[model samples]
Each structure stands twice: as structure tokens, then as C-alpha cells.
Target: MKRVDVAYVLLFDEQHEKVLMVKNKGANSSYYTLPGGAVEAGETLEEAAIREVKEETGVDIEIGGLSTVSEAFFEERGHHALFFTFTGKIVGGKIEILFPDEIEEIKWMEIDEAETYMYIPEKLNGYVKTNISIPYILRGNVIDKG
Candidate 1:
């Protein structure tokens, strides 16, 4: 099984009321999640974050501080992945779904609304504004399967 370090770019609107999201295409087409992808070989975490967002959303972004993280060993998928989620700033481009085969729709969603549609809603359930913890990191390996 291959091991991969995945990165996600979390971009909020100017008002910070909404978050950028993508309803993905392909296998998990119905799943709504943040826009980002795998961290390729030799790519820095920040570079992966920026590249993923652009490739998925066609929007150039300036990555910010690490927002959250989680690690997963997917027995079903036959791989283990470490995930990094980072805050991002929109530097250019529009909300264009770059890869139609992989991305179905793009939208800026309300925080509450986003949580409801997230692939892992519990990741934010007990989160507080002051305390920042890696999303879903405490969940067990086999039992806490997404």
C-alpha cells in the first residue's frame, strides 16, 4: 500500500461567514469537502496546499497557518494517509471547477451549513474558537472509521 501526505486548503470568504467547498465527482461523488489533493513528491506542504486548490478549484491561493490535521489508515482503500488542513487566502482567479471528472460543484458555504454537508461532520462538533486541535485525530484507528 502506498503512503501519502494529503493537504487541504480551507478558504473562507472576506466576511469569514462562508467556507469554500467542493462536491466531488467520481467514486465519492456525493461527498462534500474542502478542495485539495495529494502532496506530490518533493512538494512542500504549503506548495501542495496551493497546487491542490488551484487544480481542483482553478483559484490561486496563498496558504496560511495550519488549521487542523488528522491521520488515517484506510484498510479498505489499502493506504495510510496523513492529512493537513490549512487556512488559505484567495489571491486570484474565480470559482471555477477545474476538473469536471473529479469535481462536480463549487460553492462558498455557511459554516454551519458546511458542517452539515462535510464528509466528517464530527470533526467540528466539539470544536471551540479559542482551542485548536487536529480534526478527528483522537478517533480510534479501526473503530472510528469514516
Candidate 2:
């Protein structure tokens, strides 16, 4: 299987009431996800997270800590992905969709709404509402086996 690594950043407003999210324009449909993307070759997870956030949302972030680690296998596609989520604080820059081709819109969504619209809700439950000290882990397949 081909292994892919992705990093995401969770940036909350000063009040910690809203999160920064991006709506990605996929081939078949559009979906909301945190501001992040795949890790580039030779780049560390933290570096990738910061770079992706800037590219996708024009926001600069300082990673605070790892929030969650999720892995999924796509049997049919012969792919495995390791997703790292990190909590970050916005250090500079403003919100903007830097890549219009890949991202449609960027918004500061409410915590409750973000939970509902996130691509992987379960992976976010642990840290979305309550900040956990340890990274929440999720391991499974993209498709059901049963």
C-alpha cells in the first residue's frame, strides 16, 4: 500500500468559540475540513502544518501540540494515510483562500457547527470540545469490512 502523511491545524478564535475551516472543492463534491494538507517530502509534520495552513487559508500558525493521530486504510485504492492534527495559534496573516482551485471558501465556524461538518467527526470529538493532554488515536479502514 502507498503511505501518505497529512497534517492539519485547529485554530480557534481568541474566545475559543470558533475554528478556522476550509471548504475544499473535490471532484465529486465539496466538503469542509480543517486548514491543512499532505506533508511534502523531507518536511516535518509541524512544518507541513504551517505551510499547508498558509497555502490553503493564508493564515500563519504556531503549532501548540499534537491533538490527534488518525490512520485509515483504503483497501481498494491500496493506500494508507496517517493524519496528524495539531492545535495552533494564529501568529500572523489574515484569512484568505490562497488557492482558489483547491479551496472554495474559508470560514470561522462555530464549534458545534464544525463538529457536524467536519469530514471525520469521530477523530475530532476528543479535542474539539475538551482539550485532552494525550493525542486521541483512531485506527480503522475507510470502508466497512462487515
Candidate 3:
């Protein structure tokens, strides 16, 4: 059986009609995505979301309700990740590049502009226009026997 871990996808800055996203480093370099990471040991999903956002972007955000959940499987790595997507609001601190190694750049992107980015998933793109607030839990490609 593969190991499963939880993560979060956060959307913020409705005022500018933009969402805060980060450009990841390493082999998948130049790929830009949301500001979030793995949930650390013993930390709640919300806590992990808040912590990851701040650690990656240097901004404190008031996490809003759950938006979506997704399960991603990495066949080569033999691991799966279940993600909880949430809406967040900037509460304090200025947005700055915090973790350069993990994050290459931080930017605000309009809905239309985001489509050009390679990291934004296909399923998530529709939500930008629908304006529907619903929690979505996505199962990965792998089938579960139980």
C-alpha cells in the first residue's frame, strides 16, 4: 500500500480578482502553484495550511471555509496525497518571498492569467468563473479495495 499525506490549496485576494500563488523550485522548476505544502506531524489541516502559506509566502491569512479536496498519486514515487483546498484572506504582514529554495516566486494572478500557468490543475480552472463555493474531494487514479 502507498502512503497517504494531507495538504491544502489556498485562494486569497478577491479584491484584486487574483489568487496568491508560488513558483516551486527544483526539478519541476518554473511550475507555479498555490502556496501550500504537506501537513506536518500532529498538526490539524487548517494549522498546516496557515503554516505552509506563511512559511512559503511570508503572509498571515485568515483561513476561510473548505473549498475542495483532491487526491494526487505519484506512480513513480509510490505515494499519494490527499489535499484540502481552502479560501483564505490576508490578515497581516506584507507578502514577501520567504522560502527561496521551496518557492522561487510569489505573485498575484487574475483568473484569466492563471490559465497560462502550467501548475493550475484542469478541474480547478472552472471554479474561477462559476463562483460556486463547495467542498470537493477528489480521489486519485488508483482504486481502493476497501
Candidate 4:
């Protein structure tokens, strides 16, 4: 059986038509993506999103309702991930790049331009098309037990 993990991809509204995003680190470091990470054991999905957003962007957020869910499999990495998407509102904290190792830079871009970013997963693209200004969840694949 393959390992399974949960992650959140946060979308912060700037009170305009633009949304906040972060340039991911590691192999796909060049592409920009939402600020979120893995869900730790004993934590709820919403808790993980709030924690991840603060940890990655240094901005505290009020997580809203679920928007989407996606299951994905990484054949090359031999891992499965279930992404839970949540809508969030920026409540407080100064915007700063907190996780330098996992994120390169934080950027605000027009909602329409979000697709230009390579790291915007395909599952997210669907939600973006429907709801113009809401955060979404993507719950990904479960490991197949044989």
C-alpha cells in the first residue's frame, strides 16, 4: 500500500480582483501556488489550513467552508494525496515570507491570471472557473489496498 497525506491550498483575497499565492519550493520551485501544506495527525482539515497559511505566509486567516476536493496519485513519487480545499479570509498579521525554504515569494495576482501559474493544480482550475472569488478544497486519492 502507498502512503497517503492531506494538504490544503489556501487562496487569500486582497479585497480586489487579485488573490495571494506563493512560489513553491523544491523540484517545482519555479511555479507559483497557494500557501498550504500537509495535515498533521490529530488535526482537523480546517485547523491544518489555518496553521499552514500562517506558517507559510505569516498571515492569520479565518477558514471558511469547503469548496472542493480532489484525489491525486503521484506515480513517480509512489505517494497519494487527498487535498481538502477551504475558503479563507485574511484576518490579521503582516504579510511576510515565513517559510523561505518551502516558498520563494508571495504574490497577488488577478483571479484570471491565476491559471498562468504552473503549479495551480488541474483540480483547482475547475473550481476557479465556477466561483470567481472563493477558496476551494481538493481531496485527493486514497491508497488502494490489495
Cα-based TM-score, every candidate: 0.79, 0.83, 0.77, 0.75
Runs of candidate 2 with Cα error greater than 4 angstroms are 119-126, 133-146
Per-residue alpha-carbon lDDT of candidate 2 for residues 69-106, written as tens digits (9 for 90 to 100): 88889797788999888888898998887789999999
Off by over 4 Å in 3: 14-16, 115-125, 129-131, 134-146
lDDT of 1 by residue, 1-146 (tens): 77989998778788777889998876744678888888888887777888889988889987656666778898988989988877667989888877888888999887777756544457566342222333332134221111
lDDT of 2 at 113: 82
Tens-place lDDT digits, model 3, residues 1-146 = 47565555456475747778888886854777778888878876667878988888888876665665667788988888776666666778788987777788898887667645524477667565443345322243221111
TM-score head-to-head 3 vs 4, winner: 3
lDDT, candidate 3, equals 0.68
C-alpha lDDT (0 to 100) for residue 12 of candidate 2: 86
Q: Give the C-alpha miss distance for residue 64 in model 3, angstroms.
A: 1.0
Candidate 2's TM-score reads 0.83
For candidate 4, which ten residues in a row score worst on lDDT? Answer: 137-146
Per-residue CA lDDT of candidate 4, range 63-102, in tens?
Answer: 7665556677889878787766665678899789877887
Instruction: Report every candidate's CA lDDT.
Output: 0.73, 0.79, 0.68, 0.67
C-alpha RMSD between model 3 and the true structure: 7.3
Candidate 1 residue runs with Cα over 4 Å from true position: 116-146
Candidate number of the best lDDT: 2
